[model samples]
Target: MPLSDHEQRLLEQMERALYAEDPKFASALEGTGLRTRTRRAVYGSAAGFVVGLGLLMGGLFLHQQWVSVGGFVLMLAGAVFGVTAWRRIPRLALVDPRTGAPVAKRRKRGGSLVDRMEQRWQHRQEQQGRGGGF
Candidate 1:
């Protein structure tokens, strides 16, 4: 689900605070570098696969068994390399830059979705009890 307006504002505020606290760390954790490398890897792998296909066809036409086997191995290697690289790219940076520890490990409360929802509900109740808006 999309974030509510308040949640969006809170997220922006947190991002601003992170940048203010450590601009260098924040930028390093940013995903653009990882994305660029992954993109290059994907493109390179695709090119390799194509070249391997040509080799396979050429070997077949020339009745060269070893060349065909090599081409097949090349194609498999390219696919495996691309897949491993893609999987290695992280979706989120959850580490505390200064501490070098995962954010989840530092939190007192549980980090599961259900636990988070319960915390939110409790927070909402407390706010409402105090005549405050979330």
Candidate 2:
């Protein structure tokens, strides 16, 4: 369920209070730690891929089919791991650069194009009424 205006205001106040009271804890709770871990994982995966390449070349030079297959498997595993980790890295842009709080995503309106236009018109009218529309 969507939050009521009062509820949203209350939530915002609570968030601000949390930030004010212990920013370090709040930041830790944020997904930044996960992002960092995923980044490290990506780096590790890249290193693994390089090692796999070296193994593959060594196996070829030694005319070893089993070793060549193992190297190829490692390379495939590393590529998969790196891709997954890269995808898991949270978007930094979604976080507020100033307060380090996550910016709320705008909820998309559920309606037809005409309905959306009408809503936009209403919003513009409200803004003009508030003497801020340009």
Candidate 3:
């Protein structure tokens, strides 16, 4: 749903107020988008994984337990990095520079934990009204 004109104006006012209150913080936040950061994280992790693989192979060929352990650790860290980046990918949205508000409309991609819980609560209310019980 789109915001009413009044609501939009109110939001813009709030944004201007926030920016006026802390220009430095607002400027820092304007540096990059979530997608850009996510891409960088994914790329960095992939590079780490490649390096880890090389280390692992070198360690294995030389029969060095310590190097092998280090490689395994690196590989594990890379996998964790990649997974976290992937998880955060869906939450990316474009921000409006002028208002510092998200430009993209929210889509129902099952939503966050709070949204899911709110949905469940509404469903339960409807079921109760219908005299259904668990």
Candidate 4:
């Protein structure tokens, strides 16, 4: 579930405290986010694939099996490189550059079904205690 306003404020306070306490550690933890890294990988892979294609075509025209095999290897390597980079792209904590503090990314997955049910049950109990009707 999305954080309540109160929770968000509390989290911001905690982040500020962390930055104030040890900025060096916070900065060290920060990194270029996944977008930049993925873009670089894409560009590199595209270039490699094109070069490999060219080499393959040249080898076919020249009737050199070894050259064609080398080109195929290059293409395979390029694909592997791209896939590895994509898989390894870390989920970076969004950080404020000026303060060198971590920022919270919104949670993609809400609480599990059981957790949600429990929360609703607790909320109902609280409301009943306050004399609120069903």
Sort every candidate by TM-score, greatest first. Answer: 2, 1, 4, 3
The predictions' CA RMSDs to the true structure, in order, are: 11.9, 8.8, 7.6, 7.9
lDDT of 2 by residue, 17-105 (tens): 77677777766666777888999999999998988888899999999988888888899999999999999887534445457676786
- How many clashes (backbone N, Cα, C below 3 Å) per candidate? 0, 0, 0, 0
lDDT of each residue in 35-93, candidate 4, tens digit only = 67786997798789778877898899999988888888888888888888777776544
Weakest ten-residue segment in model 1 by summed lDDT: 100-109
lDDT per residue (tens digit) for residues 3-68 in model 3? 886986687676556566775666556545676888889999988988888889899999997898
- For all predicted structures, in order, the TM-scores are 0.49, 0.52, 0.46, 0.47
Best by lDDT: 2
Backbone steric clashes in candidate 3, count: 0
**Model 3: how far residue 88 lies from native, Å:** 0.7
RMSD of 3: 7.6
Which of candidates 1 and 4 is the stronger one according to lDDT? Answer: 1
All candidates' lDDT scores? Answer: 0.76, 0.81, 0.76, 0.75
Model 3 misplacement above 4 A: 1-32, 91-134
- For candidate 4, list the clashing residue pairs, or say none: none
Which number leads on TM-score? 2
Report model 2's TM-score to 2 decimal places: 0.52
Where is model 2 more than 4 Å wrong at Cα? 1-26, 92-134
Per-residue lDDT of model 1, residues 1-134, tens digit only? 98886995677667657766786778686776887899899888878888888788889999998888888888988888888877877655444455644455233446689989999999999999999975
